[model samples]
Target: FKDATVWTSEEEGILVHTDVLIKNGKIAKIGKNLWAAGATIVNATGKHLTAGIIDEHTHIAALSINESGQNSSAEVKMEDVVDPEHIGIYRNLAGGVTSAQLLHGSANPIGGQSAILKLKWGANADELIYKNSPKFIKFALGENVKQSNWNSYSRFPQTRMGVEQTFINYFQRAKEYDLKKKNGEEYRHDEELETLAEIINGERFISCHSYVQSEINMLMKVAEKFDFKINTFTHILEGYKVADKMAAHGVGASTFSDWWAYKYEVNDAIPYNAAIMQSQGITVAINSDDAEMSRRLNQEAAKTVKYGGMTELEAWKMVTINPAKLLHIDERVGSIKEGKDADLVLWSANPLSVYAKAEKTLIDGAVYFDLEKDKQQREAIKKEKALLINLMLQEKDKGSPTQEPKKKDQEQLHCDSL
Candidate 1:
């Protein structure tokens, strides 16, 4: 990319009229007037270049967002249900989102494990996921976990306090299971307990769905008892109430910008949630729990500036570096710097502005979404569809055998949609 206004998502600040070079799928250099031999140059004049948006919480690529067969579904993995061909992948690419955490839904107290994706279009499931991916599991609190929407009167944890007991009971069982396994005692392998054991051993992290402050504090206390910290609290609408405690406990907060009153417990949610958490020294990230909202995270990040007076750079971090930090993938992405993966987006204007649109989005130095290429693809698809329909009509005139038409359903799910 040549002669663009670069926001490095680092302390180096914005570099105007800067040139960036990508080689071997990594950022080669950033300087004034850079040139590369045998390279396809992108004319980035009058454009803004920044690291690709990292959605800390999303459910775009997965087939099933929840595993609610039991109170704890830690054994299930979201990677198993990943739909790489989902249009959301291409849509997210067009929106400048290069990576995302495809987390499980908030159906159970202990939701299924998560999948980390790079948003690589047309790739297979295994290729879409990162190699040696960090392990993460989803946990939940509040109404969803307690069967508020399901109307299940027989559910075990039908109240808020039972939610806390669910965590304690599982963690205690996992502790005993780990101790017995460590002692070399031969026992049957249990996938569910094994996952909980990983959490107890700090081998896997937890991204919890939270709302009220009391449950947030409850889980933190339980984690402290087990000697582990919660990695992130996604949809933590009421995080501002316990920002200091969260900062002290060293848990990251990934929250919405101004989502409120959608539910009863989230009444305390405020637009200043992210800013307040950041001010208290907590790593804060802006998240999109919905598919459409995920496409315009820049606008969500910009909300912090309007509501709580965060700087543009700080607001940008809420979508970029801060999410990278929460996902533990900052070393490889989330910034424009030498020796990092070249996950970048070229925007038409200031990325924090509502009018800004992604002209080009790249992952690992490969262009995944371009305005011109997208137009070409749309035209080609139209032509192909016309040809196919013509052929089908000819077949129908020839009295060819056919089955009844069936409508396929493509359900769009979010953290609590199920």
Candidate 2:
């Protein structure tokens, strides 16, 4: 039962006093005060129950966010490098996050692949993956790759043209590599280019890091030349200029809420970027490139109202459905509908409010986080730690040191005394 504000997929929005029945990790039924036999019911009466928030772009849980040693480093996978116990995962879940696209950093021209992850707290890495998630590559543009922040004296692709060329060069190599592999040419294995070749063959999609109009157009041309589409552009600060082109190219754009002026290339970024892109029929999503912004994703969606006058539901879609669509996991996790995995959150007040708190978070029919349980867990952890520390100190005061290591050292010394 989604207790707070229940948002059902039906035309009616935020049904009050609703009872939702969940069975076998799927919503069985929804009605006001509905009774079900043998079903575990959740009383989410004062919570805002809706689809779990999806963070379209983030670097949380990565061993390293960047692989900048080479221009193209697509061999690396975020899954292989995830740190499941990152505090950010728990924090995001507390903010109603259920899934995230853990992306590689934009330190290189062609970065590694991104992994779509469900925020299954307390689960191992394998259990956290969204089953059958689509494959995606990370292609970066503008200052991050050009080394504009640092001295560009020794870096490859120092100019915008060089960045475009780097992309093109890689695609060309990938195309040939793919052709050889397909024809059974028995060529030496190259992991990096193997991933690029997947993009060339339309087996994987590209999510580019973009800013500035010229570079945006350049990346699109490179994608077109390689006979594959650029799926989405993350942080497309100059997207307003090429919104129509992005729409025509069938490329989605995931962008910041109102970020600007953090760098020289992003000086022209306007708050209405999302609205402008959406106006041109481009599928747009608001993302948290920063860790802190990810928690209050509802507020990020609200910025569209101030900037472009988007409806509340439309704005909410930017953080929910649109991101799920871009990640190609829409069918499973984006909305509160019957038959979808029951990944949802219940909030204490209007989710967009700064004061709102997620009362409960559920994933795959299991209550993963409950506010009250979390509070108790925190207190228990503190008490346990304090007790353990005191016990260690007591042993120390009694002159009973950790004896295993010392015993080993003494035994070695005694043997040497022979």
Candidate 3:
């Protein structure tokens, strides 16, 4: 891209009238009046360019959300159920999101593992995953795991204290399992215990779904007991209350801009949670747990500027670099640095503003969503629909048998699905 106002999401902040060169799917150089012969030129004189948005928490590409057969779904992997043809992937691309962390639902005390994905629309399941991405598992606390919303009392750990004990029991079993394996003792292979053993051995990280401070502290202490760190806390509504504790624990916070008071546990959530967490030396990222909201995440970052007095550049990082850091993919696609993956978005205006539109969204230097192409596709669809309806009318005129149209079933599996 040429001659654009670059929001580097780095120490230099925004640069004006700069030229960025992307070569071989990596950012080659960034400077003024730069030119490469035979390279495509994008005249972005009055536009803005920034790193592609990364959603820290999402469930868009998953075919299923939960495995309720057991309270500890540690053996289930999110990668095994990826839905490549989901429309949410293309929609997120149009909204300038290039990457996301597809996590498991918050139903089990120990839920399924996570799938780190690059939003490569039209790709196959395995092709969409971020290669060699660090392992991540979902852990939950509070009401959902305790079955507070459900009338059934059959699920174990129906209380908050039971949630803690559940972890202790599993980790204890995993610890013994690890010891047996190290001692070269013969034993039956347990997938669930193997996954938990990875966490104990520091080979995998945890992203907990939590609300309120007590459970937050409880999980952190339990992690300490197991000698591993809780990597992140997603949907952390009341995180402001334990900002210092989280920072001391070296845990990152991925929170909503203003989502709160929707549930009993989130009654104390404040819009300033992101800013407060950042203020206390905690890495903070604003995440979208909802599919519809995931597309407009840039504006969600803008909300932090209003709610907590964060600067424009700082707020932008909340969606870009901070989330990348949380997902451990910052070294590849977070910023506009040289040699990094050329995952970028060209905007019609300042990206933080609601008025801005993603004119182009690119991953690995390939344009996946183009506004002009989208407009053309819309017109083409209208023409095709008209043609199809006309053919159907002709069939009716010929006295041909016709069947009523049946709507395709939409699949959206939540925690309660199982």
Candidate 4:
């Protein structure tokens, strides 16, 4: 990218009139008038360039987000059900998102393992994964796990206190399983226990779906009892009330920009929650759990500036380096620094502005989304849809059977879904 205004999202911050050189899918250089022999130059004059935006939390690319038959489902994985053709992947790339944490649903206390993916649109499922990314498990607390929204109470842990005991009981069993295995005692191999043992041994990290200060404190205490730490608290809308405690526990927070009051537990959620957590020495990242919101995470970061008086650079970091640090992928794709993956976006204006559009998005030095190309594709899609509709009308005129058009499924399942 030549002669672009760059937001490096590094300690040095923004650089003006810079040129970034990409070679073999990594940022090879960043300086003025940078040139390479036989390199394909992208003339980005007067454009804005930055590291690709990261969505720390999302449920895209998965066919099924939950295996709700059991409360403890650590055996399932998001990668196992990934759908490479999901349109959300391309849409997110158009909004400059290059990578995301594809999470499992919060239908139970212990959910499935997560998949961290690069927005390599049109690639196969395995090719889209961020290879060797840190292992992360999903844990849900509060109403969702307790079945507060359910009409029946057949499941275990139907109350807040019961939820705490469920975790304690599971961890205790997992500890025993680990101890026996370590001692070389004969034991049955249980996938669920194996996953929990990894947490005890610090082999896996937790990104918990949480709300309400009391339950948050309870989970941390439970983690302390089990001799493990929570890596992050996703959807921690009420994080402000427990900022000091979360900081003390060394858990990062991945939360919505300013979401609140969608449920009873989040009544006290404030727009300043992210800033409050950051001020208390907790690493905070703004995450979009919704697929549509996942596309425009830059606007989500901008909200921090309005609510917390955070500088634009600091706000941008919340969606970039801060999330990278939380997900343990900072070394790979968070900033436009030398030796990092060339996952970047060329924007028409400052990314913080609502009018800004992602002109070009690249992942690993490959163009995944281009505005001009997208325009052409949209026209083609319109023609295809029109042709299909005309055929359907012809069939109707011939008195053949016809059915209503299928609606796109936009149903979102949160922690409280029954």
Candidate 5:
């Protein structure tokens, strides 16, 4: 990409009329008049270039997001159910999102393990995962896990206090299990306890689904008791209330840009949650729990500017470097550093502006989405739909039997919906 206004997302701010050279799927250099032999140069004059957006929370590629039948489901994994053909992946790429943390639903207090994936549209499920990414698990607190809105009451941990005990009890069991294994005592292997043992051993991190301040504080305390730190708190709408505690605990905050009042637990949610947490020395990242919201995360990051007086660089970092750091993939894909992966977006305008559009999105230095190509694909889809409809009409005129199309309902899965 050459002659573009670049938002490098590094310590130094934006660069004007800069050239970027990508080689072997990594950014090789960033300077004026950068040249490479036998390389195809992209003319990005009058456009904007920035690191591709990273969504800290999402459930786009999964066939099933939850195993709510159990109180703890650490055995299940989001990677085992990834669907590469899901159109949401392509849509996200078009919106400049290159990577996302595909998390499990917040049905159980201890949810399943998560999968961090790159938005490589045509790749198979195995190819989509970010290779060698750190392990992460989804934990939940407050109403959703306790079944506050559900009609059924058979699940365990129906109260906040019960939730806290659940973590304590499980961690204790996991510790005992680890001790037995370490001492070479013969014991039955448990997948759930084994995953928890990894956390106790600092081999895994937790990205918890949370909202209320009290529950957030409780989880942190529980983690402290177990000698582990909660990696991040997702959907932390009431985070501002306990910003100091969370900061002191060394936990990151991955929250919605501005979400509130959708449920009783979130009544106290405020738009300034991210900025407030940032002010308290906590690393904050804006995340999208919804599929539609995941596509427009750049616009979501821009909201912090209006709601919390964050500068453009800080707001943009929430969706880029901040999320990368939380997910432990910052070294590879977060910023436009010389040795980083070439996951980037060429925008029609400033990414923070509402008028901006992702003209081209690149993952591994390959164009995954281009505005002109998208237009052609849309036109092709329309033509194909019309042709199919015409063929159906001909079949009807010939007195052929026809059946009504089946409508399969896509389940609306979110952090609270479970």
Candidate 6:
């Protein structure tokens, strides 16, 4: 049990100075200075506790983010290629991220499906999965998919129209594939299109990589024609221009903070994309496409205040509730509420400040990161590993047959795979 000034990510300016009780890894209760006689209590009098941040789009665990061999390669699953020991997960947990949607990159017109991972620090890859999480696919547009500015040998999708046709062709093939599978046709297995058929049947949602308004509108129409929806448009640099259309399509936007002009297609990218999308009643989320950017999501949310005059709470929602809703995991997380998973972060100061730090990060009522303890643990691990390695080398010098060194592959599911 712990007592803190909780910021539930509910109503604006609403902070509850209460005790949060945890039992069996779930939030047991939240009330005013409550007591539990035999339970351990940690006083959080000055810290601000809020739900752990969720990264809507990330590619941290995969061995390769881009499967650009073909334009529409939906057969691959990010889960199959997850590198459970990626050090990036630990860094993200230190930054207060508890959940992340590990997405495929925007290299193909229709990329692969994404994996919703829970940052269970020190857990195995299978354990990191958010069980029963909603399914989503990655589709891409603009220069990345079109290969307009990049000198690449990839075939097809070299133009905007080609990109749209690539998506249409994949869906059309997927629809027929679904019918064939339903009818028990002996179709030679094609893993790529099999995943796309799921999307056409509304089994999986789409998170597109888009920029220009033309491609944005095109993808929406394609989804509309198929009677399926593009769930969210990631890195929608030009989303401000088509906020109304996106709102009508019920598509959310996850974009970077003031990142623009890196490519010719992003000439019109604006810092106010998130705010404009919100103004049009379209769900908007500020995302960190880069590793460093994710650590300061609070500041990314603050950008809405500077560029679009959005209220602080609204900006906060862009990172918290709005992202959870978009990912279809709102019921379990994204807010510090009773009966929800006890995934929370305690901030030392106003989280929006550049200097703010995550004092502690908890997932399922277990402390995943403690800055001071991490430093100590790291040093201990370094010493132990050095000692063991030295012993192994000495044994090898003595020509001991039993001293054959173990390979890296034998490190069974170590933690920090978060």
Question: lDDT of all predictions, in order shown?
Answer: 0.93, 0.82, 0.93, 0.91, 0.93, 0.80
Candidates 1 and 6 compared: the better one by TM-score is: 1
In model 3, which range of ten residues has the least summed lDDT? 409-418
Tens digits of per-residue lDDT for model 4, 257-314: 8888988989999999999999999988989988889888999999999999999999
By TM-score, the best candidate is: 3
TM-score of 5: 0.97
Better of 3 and 6 by lDDT: 3
- Clash counts for the predictions, in order: 0, 8, 0, 0, 0, 4
| Greater-lDDT candidate between 3 and 4 | 3
User: Pairing residues by index, what is the TM-score of model 1?
Assistant: 0.95
TM-score of 2: 0.89
Candidate 3 versus truth, CA RMSD in Å, comes to 1.1
Candidate 5 at residue 269, lDDT? Answer: 95
Ranking by TM-score: 3, 5, 1, 4, 2, 6
Please provide, for model 5 over 250-329, each residue's C-alpha lDDT reduced to its tens digit, 9 standing for 90 to 100.
99999998889988999999999999999999999999999899889999999999999999999999999999999999
What digit string (tens of lDDT, one per residue) describes model 2 on residues 215-303? 98888888888788988999998899889998988899999989999878899999999999999998889998767888889899889
Stretches of candidate 1 off by over 4 Å are 386-407
Score residue 329 of candidate 5 by CA lDDT: 95
Candidate 2, residue 304: Cα displacement in angstroms equals: 1.4
C-alpha TM-score for every candidate: 0.95, 0.89, 0.98, 0.95, 0.97, 0.88
The candidate with the higher TM-score, 2 or 6, is 2
Residue clash pairs of candidate 5: none
* Candidate 2 wrong stretches, greater than 4 Å: 2-4, 8-13, 183-186, 382-418
Q: What is the lDDT of residue 173 in candidate 4?
A: 97
Which residue ranges in model 4 land beyond 4 Å of their true spot?
384-418
lDDT, model 5? 0.93
